[model samples]
Target: MPYLTTADGAEIFYKDWGTGQPIIFSHGWPLNSDAWDVEMKLAADNGFRAIAHDRRGHGRSTSTYTGNDMDTYAADLAALVDALNLTDIILVGHSTGGGEVVRFAAQHGAGRVVKIATAGAVPPVMVKSDTNPEGTPIEVFDSIRAGVLADRSQFYQDLSAQFFGTNREGSTISQGQRDQFWRQGMQVGLAAAYDCVKAFSETDFTEDLKALDVPIFIAQGADDQIVPIDDAAMKSINLVKNGTLKVYPGAPHGIAGSYQQELDKDLLEFWLS
Candidate 1:
């Protein structure tokens, strides 16, 4: 198993495939790098070096109790990029992974990154504030923490439906899709997973988005229930100096699985462009 050990002693398991321009993938909350398998394969098949790592404390990586915050997450990502000695990278992130991508670029990417793409990502902050009146209420995140503490298994099962929009009308998500989400969520460490709810829900990425100078492709599911398009992708597009927004009319938060082909092609085109 290929792994990169962070400065803080976290072992980040990664998958590196194909050989060409590097495309690094970051996954969402409570899920592992396996979540990006389809997209990674698509990149690899198209003559790109696809790389994805299980974030610290998720999937096969070290599940440390400390350093579950966004800054730490970004630093862990920097460790991976430095360890691989990658340059001119194309970063792709989904959901919380999107937050990680922007944060990493803002703090560490510099000349290393060429382009970025995010799908159904959480960015520019998700929690409501006096200034950001349209954001999701903090109480909603409190409830998520409550659910994680009360019964995480049931919580993940129910969240999976919303994550993939299976609970929505006309959704074509399969039982396997929901099951895989639950399986991935369950694999995460309890402490890390619990701490991450706050990290993904409250961490402000407004400054991070503004710092990006590379071409950014923001893809959103118009009907995304997990991270509403308005609060996330819609707001994110405007913050990036060089950005392109692609809205999928009825897609859900888990667009990578539910709308795989469309996203894969769009990402490939963006990279080639």
Candidate 2:
């Protein structure tokens, strides 16, 4: 298995493929690089390099229960880019990964970043602090953290329903798709999942989003439950200087699988333009 050792000596598992301008993807909480298979293949076929890393403690990467915060996540990404010498890269992040991209772009500067997009991202902050009034309540995330640490398997299964919006009545679903998502969630470490619940929920990306003067796209599924579509992606676009917004009606948080073709077309045309 291929791996890149971060500065802190944690081995980060990653997939790097094809050749051309790079498209680096960061997966959401509790999942690995495996989250972007469809999108990665499309980018590879479309004449670009695609790279994705399983954040430390997730997937086949080192499962050490340390340094699982957003700063470390972005730092690990920086190490990966520096080690690979990738430039003009498009950073695509979903959920918590979106927070990582914003921090990485701001902390490292956007010279290496050609473009950025956050899907179901946790940006402009997710938690309702005194500073940001309209954010999600901390108690809601605390309940999630408790649920994950208590019964991971059951929690993952229940989460599957929310991610795909299968919890709703009369929504047809693929059993295989649900099973795959459950398997991915189970593959991640419980401690990592538990810690990152708070990590993603509390990360404040307002300054990071404001600092970037580059083109940004915030795509969200209006019906997202795990991470509300409005606060995560929609609010992010409003904060950035040059930002494009796209909303998928009635789509769930895992819109990558549900709307892959549409997203692929968006990326291809966005890159070409």
Residue-wise C-alpha lDDT for candidate 2, range 222-245, written one tens digit per residue: 888888766777778778999999
In model 2, where do residues sit more than 4 Å from their true spots? Answer: 256-258
Q: What does candidate 1's lDDT look like per residue over 131-212, in tens digits?
A: 8899999999999888888999999999988888888778788899898999999888988998998899889999999999
Residue 266's C-alpha lDDT in candidate 1?
A: 93
**TM-scores for the candidates:** 0.98, 0.96
Clashes of each: 0, 0
lDDT of 1 at 69: 91
lDDT score at residue 48, model 1, on the 0-100 scale: 95
